[model samples]
Target: MPRRVTVLEVGLLVVLVGLAGCAGMGTSVESTATSTTDPATTAGATTADTPVSTPGSGYETRTVTLRDENGTRLATVDVWVADTFTKRYVGLSDTSALEPGRGMLFVFDGEDGRSFVMRNMDFPLDMVFVAADGTITTIHHAPVESDGDLTEYTGRAKYVLEVPMGYTNRTGVDVGDRLRVDGA
Candidate 1:
């Protein structure tokens, strides 16, 4: 005799499996978010004190320097590099808060028009889009979705940096500025 499975049982099993998969998705993102590094000391320098490797996450931390049009330093930020598809897709959505002077930098293969949304994000952000030549093309102060609707911020960029809300304004980082990533 063989055991038979009912339709309801099969549906329940499928639901459980889906939930299990989703549960594991935030493991890396959460680990990376919990870093206790002091952003003040980590800015503009890539040192041993500023960890580069995030445990359980493929993200690499790098110091990014923002410069004005005349090459004067505007601001410095420590950013987690999101170069791969999976890393970029997850982004900082799983994190609750982005520390001051800390951000996530998304790198693409080449300059192209791209779009980003605050999907499942717990905080607002300022999205800075940079061209391949390091010129900033756009800056958007994106707000967290109050409703279920997500707004897309589109720009032409090879790199997109997401920082705390009003960061661009606070740091005087504006369109046409330049972004220099350490060791990039």
Candidate 2:
């Protein structure tokens, strides 16, 4: 029988793979491998923040594909999935560079209170909030700034996708478009 991999192990492996994939072009990517916080804290962390390797494995890294209106595959990116508390909190905060085809995806438990704040963001990003049925709900083009009144985008979504700035406008990924993932 094949040995089974645990969720923590797979999470670590994906993070390692992401770090390894960032060699040469820019600086290295660091893992935000922190312990899980209490439920109260997690629920209160509105500002803050998986894969079978697909269906079976617990949080595997996959190639996320963004398609146009007529189902034309526009871009395929190797994204780090943030399904954990630590991953959610440390999302793209201190990363040196997010290459042309790389970004982070945030998956939450429910489909409400999905707000994002640019606390430690170093690069401009286009935030796309997705509903439970994979429909795009809202999109925000966020910049790298942390003001006292940091803007918070709240929507009804179970998934939040953060890509490089202008990606949405440039690729024509409108509000009703959908996102598909391969190699989960």
Candidate 3:
């Protein structure tokens, strides 16, 4: 009886081995190890030489022409206009350098007493507030990351022009300078 039981057990083992034939655990382990070491397999990994979007991340910039007080064409800039929430919040943040000719134009829906501050900005800029009738109400010179006790230029201006520091002086842009937004 013991010899017969032994023969039955051996037969069962052979049947199980035949049914589960040749599946490799090593293949799965090797694939996982290879993916772990491969840089391209890493999620959200990019090369250091990856090209970032020009004119910034959230901005939709277009070529714009601006003139100075003497009607001199100062620059042809890719002017970015703010429309969405992210664009409005992150206006010019991390911009350590600015092109001499380019600037941003902020447009509001209606005339309201609005104030602006330079928060998270890396460069000095001039804020020109304009009213509905294209009248510049006030000019605010804000330093880099200036969120101090800066006074708000109180006016009901619907437009705001953010230009580089000393740009107003160079272009002779003064208070009451009429600003015309093309296709506004």
Candidate 4:
């Protein structure tokens, strides 16, 4: 027999969806896509000893830029592209501080539909999901919380860019903004 949804349950769902939308997240939970900027990946990178515009997890760094719809420069973020499986799996898991103008970019193979959780995160973050064509789809704020529930932070995105908590608001990065990656 099909399960019946109570009025309270439906109401709660509606409220939650509304809240997610207000928080710059999509109503439905989904995975992200590739890097919006398509930055080139190199083996040698700035390790813990060196912090020259370091990115989350201090992996191979790339220059990623976010611009407004009007072609205005917003932010120049130094990011580590998570192109491999291992790198993508351990993305910013135990990071405490992600300096200004720095973050991690999760680049997937194709159009992705998976959600990300804040596991072992010590600082708040703003995850920007971008399409393969470099279109910003959704911007989600992932607070420092446990990953027990694995609360998704984005919708059907091809690329996911995780930045500082206030990066979006501070830089005026809104959905539909086209971004580019330098030296990709």
Best by lDDT: 1
Worst 10 residues of 2 by lDDT: 48-57
List candidate 1 stretches off by more than 4 Å. 1-56
Better of 2 and 4 by lDDT: 4
Candidate 3 structure, TM-score to reference: 0.58
| TM-score for each of the candidates | 0.70, 0.64, 0.58, 0.67
Question: What does candidate 4's lDDT look like per residue over 50-141, in tens digits?
Answer: 43322234377778788888888776777778776546655666454434445788877776664777755655677888888888988887
Model 4 whole-model lDDT (C-alpha atoms): 0.63
lDDT of every model, 2 decimals:
0.67, 0.58, 0.50, 0.63
lDDT measured at residue 130 in model 1 versus the true structure, 0 to 100: 96
Worst 10 residues of 1 by lDDT: 27-36
Arranged by lDDT, best first: 1, 4, 2, 3
Q: Candidate 3, after superposition: displacement of residue 140 in Å?
A: 1.0
How well is each residue in 1-184 modelled by candidate 2, as lDDT tens digits? 2124468866985786577567532222222211111121221112311111111224446566667667876555556688875566556565544333556677777666466777545456678878877778898877766547677755667777777666777666788888776754
Candidate 1 vs 3: which has more TM-score = 1
Model 4 misplaced regions, further than 4 Å: 1-58
Worst 10 residues of 3 by lDDT: 28-37
Clashes of each: 0, 5, 0, 12
Candidate order by decreasing TM-score: 1, 4, 2, 3
Kindly list the per-residue Cα lDDT of model 1 for residues 1-184, writing each as its tens digit: 1123358755864675578568753211110121111244432223455333332366799988989999988877877888875567557666654444567888888887777787656567778889999999998877778537667788888888887666677667899999999898
Model 4's TM-score against the true structure: 0.67
Model 2 misplaced stretches (Cα beyond 4 Å):
1-60
